[model samples]
Target: MKLFKLNKTNLNEVEQIPFKLEKDIQSLVEVNVESVFNLKFIQSELSVDKYRIDTLCFDEENNSFVIIEYKKGKSYSVIDQGYTYLQLLLNNKSDFLLVLSQYFNKVLRMEDVDWSQSRIIFVSPSFNSYQKDSVNFKGLPFELWEIKRYSNDTVVLNEHRSNSKESIETLNPTSNSTISQVSKEVKVVDEDFHLSKTNQPLVDKWNELKEEISNLDDVEITPKNDYISLMLNGKTLCYLIFRKNSISLEMNRGNVKPDGSRSKNYFDLDDPKKISKEGSWEWKSGTKGTIYKIPINKTTDLEYLMFLIKQKYKNLSN
Candidate 1:
């Protein structure tokens, strides 16, 4: 895509700056993975078995490992390489856990990770039609991100979303058994999956909340394993956990006043630790600061919830 600079009424074309080496792209992405993807960087050039992963990252929200590969050439096959890395991860779960334990300076058990949410990400300047089409399946656990740099010292990374709705399992059998095995274990989840967990009334409330939150500037609604995250500029504004009868809203406890007093106009905050004891929801790993929960039901005031959400949005924006 072309970029331009507006000078008064005239548009001046900005030259594209090409990456000198694959490592250049890798370093840029590894350094800014958190702000760009909201993922935690574990290690670079992580070697497991005979394969070397370009970058290793963990999704704190989903408690899953993410494999990132940088490419400067267009001849590589995304499907083959992506599944190969995923297969390696699935087979060597212990090695990944060890790495995670070392990085965080704590011991982590296998059951603590959600392996089904594991996936691979491919970053490059451009992807060939064949490479893009290979990941057209809805069930493929892979993401293609195109990164570009301009001479004006600006860089943009955008995800390539596939429009196809076909599932990879429906295709004819292939010779590679790794693809089949990995596909069986790793599943792709969407908004519908989370919405299906609740009743129609709760779903309607979720839609209403989704619409109102989405109306905020540059807000992104992303569905994870257990909740729908409302994010602004890569920082989570709130987590919406759809329950059978009520939608649980999780936000940072810092949203409260400096004097530790709850706002009279907002819903009462419940301690996340206390709620977790009741088996209401699991506290996600890598969550910093204190968190408070607010349950949204039919009797709950929608305007009050939006009011609290708007405050968080404004805080994150600033």
Candidate 2:
């Protein structure tokens, strides 16, 4: 990657600085772990059984543990190591949470954790073609991030996202028994899961909404176990959960004020009353307040739904 700086009318290329050691990369990341990935730093060089975890973190939003390994060389299989670490977490939940509680001085509960969304992230200067291809499966629970530093003191971190909607369970059916067992426990949910639970009409409406949002700038749809989140620049803009008769929308602009009362005028829309049928205008839970339920039973509801979606898209871009 080439970076340029404007010197009057001419542009000068910035020199690329290669990281000297893996430890240097780890230290840089560990110091600013929360800001980079919104993860709470657990411990570095954590020796779990025979393996040593490079950097362990806790994802507060997803309520899961994220294992991040920094690599300077290319000689590891992402699938094998990723699954192995995931299996280790699954087998020993208490041990992981205990260490976290001790470090942060707070009691971390076992039941509050979401094991299915547990994943491993590999950060390196670059990834080989094989390593990138290994995580091509949509639901592998592994993320590859390439990090680089320049002489200008600017660092770039790029995540290699998969375009495939196919799950690893279907693609890797003939894999080893360990992977198969782990797959059964910690599987990634797709759009099909929501479709199976809801009716055809609601599913059709969701598809329509998804397609419309896909046309917007830098918008990507990621299907989770409970909901489908619309992400812009890796941050969640809107979260949609498929209910029995309607699709619930939750806008994640930021934290809402912690008030016990659920108000009708919660959302700052031009006409909040118009989209009331879409979902409840009242605030719901703590951080995820006001889950607006948009019913797909009528064509008019969809027309009104566009306003809610566009508002969220606009807020995210800003």
Candidate 3:
């Protein structure tokens, strides 16, 4: 079958990619080898012993197999193919995993696999009532998407289905970072302004942070002894781990180092305007390191902080 290649260059401006669902499936299979099973388009004889399948997919992570059959538009017979593939794949676990590992470049240990828990993904533009109603669409890993040709591109997109897939959710959680600023050498607020006799610099920075954070519904700030902590949606976004003589405005302390410091990680504490009164600070015993950490709630930047918290400091993902 001849494919409709999109001549346009930019993928961002275009709402859809000019590629068929099969093409998308190919690219997805090529790149995401580690995450997904291998999808191969095969043509096997419909012999009594050897039942052929449209496409075979094996998942190493779940010790599972999936049969993906593509029907042009909406076909009711896709379910029949799915069930047929299921019966055949159940008898050939070793063959599927062996081919899967070779395709993905990883060794799969499938000594005790339960093929009954396998899935079927029928790819078609639409589904009929009998196909939809009779089959346990929710129970099986079947996904339906509408293929559209818009502005010169034929794109296959996955429809958002909110199912309680505990296993899948635990494997990949939603990350909350925007900017990919994980460079350890990024400028930290190294310069210090001592909080003596109404420091305007300190106050200016503090109010700015307070105003910015207060605007977001997730954030709430209140004084805790000499320090202030920022909470986002009941989760502690950051806190001013204030020590009188050695002040360190630690943002995402869950990822703070052995001794509290971002190691010049070019990220501020949760709020730049929330500059605390730099009463007294010291780097070494008497070095006087008056520093305030200004942190932004950038989803991606808190990787280190998240790491710190997960390792020993706190629990965030849970």
RMSD in angstroms, all models? 5.4, 4.2, 18.4
User: What TM-score would candidate 2 get against the native?
Assistant: 0.82
Cα deviation of 300, candidate 1, in Å: 5.7
TM-score of each: 0.82, 0.82, 0.37
Q: Work out candidate 3's RMSD over C-alphas.
A: 18.4
Instruction: State the lDDT of candidate 1 residue by residue for 245-276, as single tens digits.
Output: 87888876443444455432333343322332
Instruction: Report lDDT (Cα) of residue 279, candidate 2.
Output: 33
Number of clashes recorded per candidate: 0, 5, 20
Candidate 2 positional error at 84, Å: 1.8
Best of the candidates, lDDT: 1
Clashes counted in candidate 3 amount to 20
Candidate lDDT scores, in order, read 0.83, 0.78, 0.43
* Between candidates 2 and 3, the lDDT winner: 2
Stretches > 4 Å off in candidate 1: 172-176, 255-292, 298-305
Error of model 2, residue 299, in angstroms: 1.8
